[model samples]
Target: MNDDMTHEPSDTTGPRRLTRTRDGRMITGVCSGAAAYFNVDPTLVRIGAAVVTILTSGAGILLYAAAVLLIPEEGKDVSIAQELINKQTSRN
Candidate 1:
């Protein structure tokens, strides 16, 4: 009848966080971060991104940019876009 016993054990490595990796980054680490989150190869992600960008007539570029703004970098808490919004709101 113990609550702790009822709950499942948590992952020792902690929950998988999607953050931009500085080591394997080519641009802003968007593709690499996404690859890590999805457990895929970084090269595959990059190629897929390129193909999508081309097929979408450049819409994928915007998506990549948005991801860069939204996804936090490795070892950082807030995303770039969040920080910018916070600064803007504070100034107003």
Candidate 2:
């Protein structure tokens, strides 16, 4: 008697999400991004960001949300910022 088994390779894909980080100062994607990048809890980064924002009287809240709308979701294969654009460009 003989037995054989085959398995397909697993796919490698990074999670894509809007970051609230200082990259653009729009929101608090920094923490989320960091968590994904370094495998850390995003809450820690958020707390750190909050502590820093204390000096500014919670100005970071507005900035964090703004970042959510600004930053683009990460791509599956390639990890890079797609960027947010307002006006559509004319195709040449």
Candidate 3:
């Protein structure tokens, strides 16, 4: 005899960053951030970044690093003020 299991899956979803790899907030270490976000090997991003740096003469690298530092962490746990801002953004 076997017992039947009849349980509905609970919803465990919420807004996540556009890039699970957190592309937006990654510092110039875009490769690293991309790797983390997309759950891909960082080596791929590293190789890509290296190629871009060589082709673009470090401009890409510089920009990537700048972005990492400037970008906010994804899934930033909402604070009271941030929630208010979100509400305002939604209204208009």
Candidate 4:
């Protein structure tokens, strides 16, 4: 058996991380980050979010807020909600 044939190829792009983008952001960048992850236009995501929010009687707003707290900003490791939970637990 050849040594070269036993090794698997490595990915150059590395794993895809879902992080909020600093560029082209309207607010918290949740839609932009999701758009980047899905490889779609940010505008489309924003429009869809708006429509969902309207149709769902503003439930989408809560979902968007949750995403903002759960999704880490670009260049950061932990998310806002995670940090807050950690702080609260540490204080006890």
Candidate 5:
């Protein structure tokens, strides 16, 4: 008769994806998206990126740029090649 016993466990095997946040974003929501995906604070991710950028002579900038291009905005569909093909097929 315990409520906790009646509750089902959440799915832990779901696909983990990174996408830009619609809110709590600064530049392009890269850091915020990463933080949300990783369950960390956005500030921490930003600080880590800053430190990495400083220590790695701008490598962080390149990584950030790649993330911006690759990570889709939240509430938007992922348009990677497979998805694109699926979309094209579904519309037919």
Candidate 6:
């Protein structure tokens, strides 16, 4: 005489924000940033970009350049040395 089991649906999270990575950058950080945003390997993104560039006759280069100029870098992780540098510069 026990029948009472109700379950609520799980909430889904949205996609990760796309931003250029400061640490994982190779050239302009576009591929690494995209990899982080899409939750994939950076090499995959690089290879895909290369394939697109080949197939589209260099359009991918333009797109990548645009992304470099438009996308903002991920949250800046300030280091102790950087903090000290900022402090010293501010005093001068």
Angstrom error of the Cα, residue 88, model 6: value is: 30
The residue-by-residue lDDT of candidate 3 on 24-58, one tens digit each, is 23433445445655555667767787788899988
Each candidate's lDDT (Cα)?
0.81, 0.48, 0.52, 0.81, 0.76, 0.71
List model 5 lDDT by residue over 1-92, tens digit each.
65432222133476766778767799988888888778777888999999999999999999988787678877666734446677899999
Where does model 4 exceed 4 Å of error? 1-12
Candidate 1 stretches greater than 4 Å from native: 1-12
- Tens digit per residue, CA lDDT, model 6, 20-92: 7765689978788788767677788999999999999999999988787667666644533456678999999
Q: For all the candidates, what are their Cα RMSDs to the real structure? A: 9.1, 11.4, 11.0, 9.6, 7.9, 11.6
Q: On a 0 to 100 scale, what is the lDDT of residue 81 in model 3?
A: 47
- What is the overall TM-score of model 2 with all chains considered together? 0.43
> Among all windows of ten consecutive residues in candidate 3, which has the lowest summed lDDT?
2-11
Better of 3 and 5 by lDDT: 5
Among residues 3 or more apart in sequence or in different chains, the pairs in candidate 3 whose N, CA or C atoms overlap within 3 Å are 20-37, 21-37, 26-68, 27-68, 28-64, 28-65
Clashing pairs in 6: none
Candidate 1, residue 44: Cα displacement in angstroms equals 0.5
Model 4 lDDT tens row, 1-92: 65432322122266877888876689988888888777677888999999999999999999999999999997788999999999999999
In terms of lDDT, the poorest run of 10 residues in model 6 is 2-11
Give a tens-digit lDDT track for model 2, residues 52-87: 689779887776655555554443322233322222
Q: Mark the regions of model 5 whose C-alpha exceeds 4 Å error after superposition.
A: 1-14, 79-92
**lDDT per residue (tens digit) for residues 1-92 in model 1:** 65422322123378777888776799998887787777677888999999999999999999998899999998888999889999999999
Output the lDDT of residue 73, model 4. 91
Candidate 1 residue 34 Cα shift, in angstroms, is 0.9
